[model samples]
Target chain A: MTDPRLLPRTIAVLGCGGLGVPAAWTLALDGRYPLVLIDDDCVELSNLHRQVLYATAEVGQPKAPALARALLEVAPQLQVEVRQGRLGPANAAALLQGCDAVLEGTDDAVSKFAVNDWAVGAPAGVQRVASIAAAIGRRGQWMVVRSAGPCYRCLFEEPPQPESLATCQIAGVLGPAVGQVGALAARSLLRVLAGEADSADGALVRLQARGLLRTPVAAAAACRCQARGDGAADSEPWGQHV
Target chain B: MFERDPKQLFDRYGRQLLVQGVQFEGQQVLHRLAVVVGCDGSPLAQAAGQVAARYLVGAGVGRAVVPQGGGTLLQQLDPLLQLAELPSEAQPPVVQLWFAARAYGASADVVWTDLSPQGPRQVRAGALQWWVGGPAPLTDAVALGAAVADLVVADALGVEPLPSLAVLDFSDPLAPRTRKHAAAAGPPLALPADPGSPLQELASKLSETLQIQQIVAAESARCYPAEACGLVVADADGQLVALAVANLQDHWHSQDPEAFSRSARTAFALDERAIAAQQRLGRRLVAIWHSHCDVGADFSAADVSGAYPNGEALYPGVAHWVVSVRRGCVAEQRVFGLEGGQLCYADVAVSGELAGRSGVEGRC
Candidate 1:
């Protein structure tokens, strides 16, 4: 009963690490659209446990290209591309131009918020973006941000102090925990593409430790991103001229 | 008849018995006299001889004699055993005097005395009534009151004198007191439900798409020797409602096992066709599902790098789904989305038939 074409017009994965590799593989294997896999680092031995994308033999290999090749082999019909470079402020717009939605999986909160702001300032077609802060330790939190919703900055307000933020390399993470949050992110994007249209415009979903696994719960109010008077009327190059 | 010295009689029973008597104005009348013996003494032999003399005097066979030492002393030892010897009329009746002494030391000294005088005169006149009354009921009541007061003080100080006793008193009759205390403590506060604000929803949506892509790589693990792949589409709430097959053909043929390589051109064409078909249906292909077979659910290095180029060339915002089925059952299913340009996992939620609370209440 829903229009299927309303799914992502363009999709991009910005990191290919413990969390990113699995995400990119899922998208490409789905063979849904032009899927982009990007990561500047190479696969390391220390990443094998949580990052399911690389194996022992693949150590020291470029992660982006490795993930792309593996995805194509599985789904020969998928349109997959790889960019072996770091994602930062300078190239953020160019990489995100045609992307209808983006998944922010970088460990840094600063980078995540930067993605959120870019998604908001980009054209309408490029506005939808989501991030997964999958678990701090054995547990993880998954959140989805849309261009229409409050950006990451709206919920967190400010990034945590550098000393407080823990990266996967430093703090360690449970592989399954990352998998669980990542799976939730994929589902949210699919829903967005379906145009369920409501206040999905400015909503966020948080997963908490309810019992055995984390349970998803919704926030009570709209985000500050949506609260800002940045009217939806802004025109950008990526906006669809419907 | 023979006369016996009083000192000799005293010597035989003095150690085992107490002799009590009264001297009236320097005259010895032997009146109000009693002989008390230890509980282990032989008092029965002494009582028999005294009864014979009394019986002889009362039956008109008067002046019948008995050994001097046994005369009154023996009769005082046990009166009930000698009662049958008295005549119906004119019987010089037998009497018994018993003295119970409370002594603290081993010596024959009496600290207190309890007396029972057995005779018709004492019973008929009701003169011994005081001896039969024991301690009064009022004394028992006082003892009980003191015990209850001690318990109350102990409970207030939380210093239970007897642990089991306190438990019994506190819980035995009923738990009314504890219940009252618990009620005054109050209940804990509850947290608000459904905190997914609008901003979180969008973030969750974008994250879910990436998760779907991850699931695709997971599924491909089922066909390790070969390659298995599928696609998925989801609703606005990030629920996978539909799925399709992506690659149904072989993209590689190797004659040399050591030099085997993936047929990149053939794979690209197949992947493109699958993406095109999903687009034609007006549905956004949220993810591509695949299997890894025996090799396990992890993405290979080739898989990671391969995803970037193929992903950017087709869809930029879409994610991937991988379902890994091992030996017929699903071992794992994951999703992948883009974090910057790198492939990372995205979280997802599978929708069920349960109606949303707001929807069921018709609030929207």
Candidate 2:
């Protein structure tokens, strides 16, 4: 088995928002890993605190390219592949192809659940691939999900109502809090790449003022998402939605 | 979207601030930063030297260092504040300093990052949008200085517990220990769980300095099979400056066979001459520290009699500290004190800026 720790690995950062920018910036500064950035959104004035990738001057620019350029400004030696579009059920499998691991920093619950589905249902070669998700603000959760443990569907079968999940947009966020999670997510990725094993397969690690809280999660016997066919093994050609 | 001046932010929310939320020692870090705030009309926005020195005492931070020399120009105040305490307020301050700086750049000119994830929204520090927004940005010089202090504190407080330390119980963990030495040590001084207490702050400063512990442990290991002793002095305010004195155990062993017997290997007897030297240095004896080379830091029967001859508390307020030096390294330390007729483990804490999230209580 190849030791990812000794070798450089590619990571797909699924969003270029608050969580993604700092995570990617810190990771790139580590000076080892190449990054694949996927985001269709544009930089705006409001995300300055959390989404630090885009500066004030680049407000109107698309985040995918803006973030790529900004990351280069911080780390010129790092390799970055920009895919300026959203990841959906239709394109997530393709967008996520050929990466050692995936970092899901998007705020959308549906997208998070879908990525969880794909991670759990991906066919051989990609079946064991893992994705680490982090959300920040007054209230947020971070989790490491792979088939070895439990899927996101095991924890929550469906996304909550829009009113239930408040991003920094509705409920404000703290500067240091975002920083804590970003640095934490980046550390988790480095650890995973180091081939450090996690005993509790599916655990949602909650950030606290003092440290972290890890809650073990087991695959639900009744979860229907876990029973779906492996999408990566599908014989269907490109453009066919899973 | 309307733009507001950054100066207006401070006028509405003055600088005299207090840092809260991280609990306990975080406030001490803030207090140290307050002591080092830049003077009026100074070129630097703030000088963190004193702050870093008092709070960041080790980990390679230096004194008389070259300033960042970046774009900060200091603010002028009427009567400079050596220590400013803003009385408790409803909303805990990020850092409270009486707003005192003439910012070289205007608020509208300096770009502020929106901490929100919705996108980079406009962020105005002061009261312009504070009515509905998150805590105002720490925009003032004093506040930023405090933030810098906090940044260092957070870094220093991240020391994880080493598995090698099976610490000797100096103070009973089950029964909270408090030592009465100063005016502030009234009642049982429970180690504070939160900041802002006068007693806890003093107790924090009284915890032995890390450098002295390292020095004493290193000095002791060099003279193996022989105990090492030192007389450490603290300023009137309780900051320790340790001075190693020769342990006259071998001299006594050469003459008095009983005195030199097992005592030379396990015990320490401080040479009295160092006291005059220490007093001339204008430092009061705070702790009489010695090292136990081969065993745990527990005080032995001979150790007790040697310190408090005839069951009398010879050193009324001084702490007797034991540094267990095993295999040429400091393994752990335990402190004992004589107060109110009982020799109890003195509760001493070296409180730093950030509270480790693990809730693993600290000695300093």
Candidate 3:
């Protein structure tokens, strides 16, 4: 098998909100992997505080294209593809086609799990890695899922009810707090690409009030990821990609 | 001797002002906070130096002193942050971020990251030390840079109490371990009052906790050689039940040896589904019980990170009982919990026998 690391990998970023904005920007600044930005939401006046990629003048513009333009303006060498649409199980494969990794930063619970399920369910030939991150009210958590480790569902079996948990819209969030998470997510992806996947994989890194706390997570036997055949068969020989 | 228009500052940093700690006074502290990024010839160090500088500027820090070649990206990232030269005379409370190896200095607080024989390590000193290590890779420089910036900001904002020393091992990145030492006297950060012993508190409050030692002892002995894990849940009747949740460590290690390097013999992973089922029982989770084979009954670093995942308690008000299983016999047991934001453990005498469901108490 060809060494996948030798090939230039494409990354698909889901959700262009607080976490995605900085994540996309950080990846663009790195200027290594080609990026595919997907988001149906438009730039809002309220998003400017935490979503640093958008400006006041760009309000009402689709987030994916606006972010692409913003990235190109700063680092013209970047290869960025814009897919302006909502991502679900149906279109996840098409939207993330030919991508080696996915950075899921969507705010809602449904979209996050959808991305997780899709990644965990990928076939042998199309095995891909993913990093899912969420931020709200001064705190955030990010985890990277690879074939060898636990999927997002393994840690959080299911998302809590909307009423039970407060979204950033309701509880409020600081710009720097989410911004820090976004950067962490982007850096984590870079680690995976740089052949240092351990630092970013399988563990959940929480951005707490004081410092970053990382907890190791394992696949639950009952979790679908554990029964996943593709995860075992298609997992690249470790260190080959590096 | 610093004066800036409050209206303009608010216009730029309005969202920051809304945060609790960064409300007017904290924002001023951040604005007054100066960080020095020391660079070296190494490419990794240079990249990390630049990442730290950019992050500090984006955070609305007042002034930054970057070694000449490093501030090129700072001006483009943010124009508000003033890039100044290193101070000549007595420095005033500046946090220094060193990307290369350096001896600890007395004057300024330091967030240091260096490549070591073991791996990449980060040390944050505000009268505290946090040493995090994993394999040495190029990304370590960038991760360390961001980590340093976070520590600097946390110190300025007083987000977390400073521990005298915290050793974080990422060798097994999947299951990282964090061990914290109590802060020394006269530390920069204020220490909160002691919350007292969690083991003693649990023993006194719950009669079952004291009586169920035999149940835990028998189970630990049964799961000998392989580490055992379970939960202590209170049913609707408010009766504490010892439920043996599957370890799942060996299962993961067998499936993915590269990621899960440790097996059931040395480590333990409680079933997430089991924990969630207990969580849904309306605040019935009293404590998570597990056995450490040959590792002693005291709470290990893994226990600390597992119980308080994300710096917040996974199960608030939940005490963790760690039983030591030595040579197929229960030697001792201890209870651990978070007290005043620190992991504190107390030894509990194994006494009393309770008749309950035996052998594989609950689902894996």
Q: Best candidate, lDDT-wise?
A: 3
Q: Which stretches of model 2 miss by more than 4 angstroms? A: A1-9, A127-131, A197-201, A209-211, A219-224, A227-242, B1-364
Best by DockQ: 3
Model 3: TM-score, first chain: 0.90
User: Which 10-residue window in model 3 chain B sums to the lowest lDDT?
Assistant: B100-109
> TM-score (chain B) for model 3?
0.43
lDDT of 1 by residue, B1-364 (tens): 1132456323322211121121111011111112121211222212211212222111111111232333342232222113222222222221222111101000011111113355333210000000101111111111111122222212212222211111001111111011111111221111111225332343355335545433433333333334566666654555654443545344333443244444321231135676676568666766555554422233344454456564462456655544433333333333555554534442232212111110112221
Interface residue Cα RMSD of candidate 1 after superposition: 44.5
lDDT of each: 0.39, 0.47, 0.63
lDDT of 1 at B256: 39
TM-score winner among the candidates? 3
- Model 1 chain A lowest lDDT segment of ten: A208-217
Rank the candidate models, highest TM-score first.
3, 2, 1
lDDT tens string, model 3, B37-66?
655445556655665555556556767776
Q: What is the lDDT of residue B157 in candidate 3?
A: 55
lDDT of 2: 0.47
Model 2: per-residue lDDT, tens digit, B143-242? 1232233233332223111111111111221221111112122112111123433323333554435566555655766665577888778766766787
* Fnat value of model 2: 0.00
